[model samples]
Target: MQSFLQVKHVIDYSKMTHIHLRDFYASLNKKPQPERVKMLLNYLIEDQRRIEKILSTFEAVSEPYILDSWMQYVSNVDIHGLINNQKIKADISLDEITELAVKFGEVLVNFYREAATKTDLEKVSNIFKNLAEMEVKDNLKQARAALFEEM
Candidate 1:
């Protein structure tokens, strides 16, 4: 019989996700132009929304820290998407932008898969599945396109 001791250790996306998410948001902050800032901010807002949803779905015990961190990150973002009618931003090259996005997505997936192998908890397993799906949905394809110069 298979034991429930199949708990898997998840990949520590804490540092990586934080770093990449910060970079994406900071990319907007670095934009001196109001228009570019506004454009990127819109994308940031959407990402914040997605992150919130992801956090909510996580089956972790300490919800407060996770939620707080996500909230703080989103809250500090400048939301001026409405102010700029002609916003176009660029910090990373288009190719680089896609590459990083996809790489991060892959890391997320790998983290979940690794965690699943290390933990026996069904909840943790579910969490990994959800997290993996979220990452796959986000930026994996963009990275692939960027990597292959297909886009």
Candidate 2:
């Protein structure tokens, strides 16, 4: 079994992911882009903030035993590599932005799902499962918003 330190590391990593993603979207928003792209970026920024808050709640509400429990495995996703490859010019198209957003969502969803499977504790597993579900829903919402903007 992994040590409790590993569990803390995983939680910290998840929080860091959201923070980095939020900052990335914010940075993209600072550049001159079409209104549609700006709107999408704004939505993404807020979504990351919401998810980060939810993760914070998990830390606050979970029992000490749950938080201290060892995880079967920790996620090994390279968040930096994923974010670094998403560079776009100021004239980036709506499709390009949408594609990037989808990629970001997919990575988080997969990470959370994998994390859920690696935890034996029911509370910890459910936390990751719920996060995955939320990310999927957010992705769909963002896609619909982008589609509507195209019309």
Candidate 3:
């Protein structure tokens, strides 16, 4: 069984991943790019910021018992490796950037799903499931917005 600390560590890592992604998008925005691409980058940066805030709120308001709960299993998701694998370039195409953002969201969704299933506690499981759902919805919205921009 994994300790509560382990779960907290994963949550912290996820939060940090969003920060890194936000910074990456912000850097891309600073570079010379098509106006549409710049707009997309701005949306992505704001989305990441929103997600980071949500995670921070969860950390702040979670009950002590819920935070201390143990998990029966934990997946071996390599979040650090996933973050490091991003190959963003200043000259990246609009489609490429959109796809990359979707990929990042998908990774988080999978991670949350796995974490949800590994826990026996209903509250903990629900929290993870809810997070996964949020990511899925956000990804779809982002993809749709990009499609409209392309059209």
User: Best lDDT goes to which candidate?
Assistant: 3
Ranking by lDDT: 3, 2, 1
What is the alpha-carbon lDDT of model 3 when measured against the actual structure? 0.82
Give the least accurate 10-residue stretch of model 1, judged by summed lDDT. 70-79
Q: How far is candidate 2 from the true structure (C-alpha RMSD, Å)?
A: 2.7
Lowest lDDT sum, 10 consecutive residues, model 2, at: 1-10
Candidate 3, which segments miss by more than 4 Å at Cα?
Answer: 1-5, 72-75
Write down the worst ten-residue block by lDDT for model 3.
Answer: 1-10
**Model 2: number of backbone collisions:** 0
- C-alpha lDDT of residue 4 in model 1: 21
Q: What lDDT does each candidate get?
A: 0.45, 0.80, 0.82
For residues 1-151, write the lDDT of model 1, one tens digit per residue.
1122222111223333444465555555576634433444445445645665555344254344332221101112111221222233644444444444455556556655554444444555565577667667766444444445432
Q: Is candidate 1 or candidate 3 better by TM-score?
A: 3
Off by over 4 Å in 1: 1-20, 32-45, 56-91, 140-151
lDDT by residue (tens digit), candidate 2, 41-99: 88889988988898888788877777777876644668656887677468777788788
How well is each residue in 32-80 modelled by candidate 3, as lDDT tens digits? 8898999899899999999999999998998877767777545466655
TM-score of 3: 0.88
lDDT of candidate 2 at residue 132, scale 0 to 100: 87
